[model samples]
Target: MAVVTTAVRSGLLFPLFLLSIDASFQRKSGTKTQNIGSFWNGSTGRSERGTELSCCALINVQMRQVFPIHAQQTRPKKECRDRLVQYNDQLDAVLGELEHHPEILLRAVVADGQYAKDLFVETVTGHGFALISKLQRNANLNYVYDGPDQQRRGPKRKHDGKVTFADLSRFDVVNESAAERILTQVVWGVRWKRLLRVVVIQVLDHHGQVIKYAVLFSTDITMSASEVVALYRSRFEIEYVFRDGKQFLGLQDAQMRTQQALESHWNLTLLVMNLARLEALRANNGAQTLVFGVEDLKRRAYNALFAQVILVNLGLEARFEELIANPSGPLNFGLKAA
Candidate 1:
């Protein structure tokens, strides 16, 4: 039987997945479908050069989702006077609908900086459990630790202001797996960045050269040696969804002027992508290998569907002209998931 079982559970419809495993199960050489749950939050620019006001649900930590939110143009254009509200209100409703069903345990939430509100944080925490999130990061994070003597030191008199990426980078340790010295390097500064932290995990590979295991996170959890690595690695799957959605899913080709249309279309696309993933998984005899990478998805789905065809064609025309004059090689349009 597959060790990783994904299920939707309880009245919460909370997208819960189970991964309870025994040692005997691991010893056997069988396929294990680990329950993948992630709350992916982020925003996208409505237009290539327009405001990035789009954010929505992501599956398996995938960044491929659409918001059913709408807003009106209310600034700069005195002639086009209107009241603009973010689509977050609608996205919140969608999440609320999903939250009622408690099957989804590992909720992967995605939102922009503005969505990091106090109420949002409380709502998610009310469930008594949920993994790390992009919601408000340093609100009262200075509260004391509460693990056993073997873990935390209980409550303290005061908090250490707020832990910054810079402070964490200075700390390092020898990993248990390969006994390599792992270092956490800060990529973004708290004062300068909204997310407060963005670090990368690096270690010397078989060769002495430093290798980036993955980009680190912004959570305040007491990261164990393996936890840091796990968090970083988890981000890759989300990125895959983004790349595939944009390239094959035609996420960037949206032309809807009103926000509601934009949001509904976006949500539909993600739903379609998930269904396709399920279809592909079944077709492959239950092997979890992702055959549909970003490139494949673009050619098969986005290119076949979405309206960015004219724009993409025009962009390629300009590139082709440039290549003819100063050819280097095929330009790498997309690679990283984020």
Candidate 2:
């Protein structure tokens, strides 16, 4: 299924893609798609020049399927008459729509570290939604007082001494999971300001040696640590969508110079991706498989088109079945149901 938001950026349909492709491919390989422009860097946290787009997606955890719901390109600063439009502003706008809309009911808003600012937390909380995001490895955190308030004081103490990641064992562990590696979660506050639920995962090698560590947190302090970890892990669904679009769906292939042309090309590319996935899923009884990727969809589409053309030109009505049959050669388009 596919849906677009009514509130587009600057009265234009949101551009789902914004990035530069090497024109060198056209010179060497005679590639057709090429669009060059100086766009901001949103995919990677850098101050370099590149096209950056803000995308909002809905992930159905039960089905493990993600659908891009809304997308908008980050316009240049000069284009805005007033102050600059920051990426966080675009996020807040997208999230605000998800909050008050009658059709959609998102439980929590999950984002990466880029949207982990205090202002972002406040904005999301104001809309009555929890924000789940990752914290830097050396994030400054402090312990909050859970006991009764002090009797004599101008203001009750809200925080205690600083917290050290190395001393996690001393703190109360709210949840723990035993798998290939051990995961421990605890309720902690960040920046000594906001109360949050944090999960600390310790990755270990086969020899039982500590190899790596990951820290995730949630603004919804009432949520369980396990739930926080689960939501944070599911945040990668949007990344997979981008990867599929760029790899197989002509996401990075478009020859345009104007902003309008680029916007149309980007939106169309993502729209095609959505349609292909929906068609493939429907064809397979709504089941998803790792083997049945976008490549399979393209192959099937090509064969279907070829079959139609042959039937039209040669007037071979009886040979239509044989032409549409699954190719048994090296390029097989048969459905490998999972």
> In TM-score terms, which candidate is top?
2
**Taking the tens digit of each residue's C-alpha lDDT, what string does model 1 give over 110-207?**
33334345444344444432323232334323212233344357744332244442234344543523424554422322332322233334455776
Candidate 2 lDDT over residue span 1-338, tens digit each: 22322212222122222111111011111223222224434455445544444566766544445666555555546554321235556556767655455444466878777667777677777777888888887888777667788899598887677767766754555544442333444445655366777777676666766567777787887777777777777777777666777778766565564546655766677677666655555554543342346767777777677767767798886766665454763224464454
Superposed model 1: Cα runs more than 4 Å off:
1-48, 51-53, 61-94, 107-120, 131-225, 294-338
Q: Candidate 1, residue 125: CA error in Å?
A: 2.2
- Worst-scoring 10-residue span by lDDT in model 2: 19-28
Model 2: which residue pairs collide? 34-254, 39-50
Name the weakest run of 10 consecutive residues (lDDT summed) in model 1.
19-28
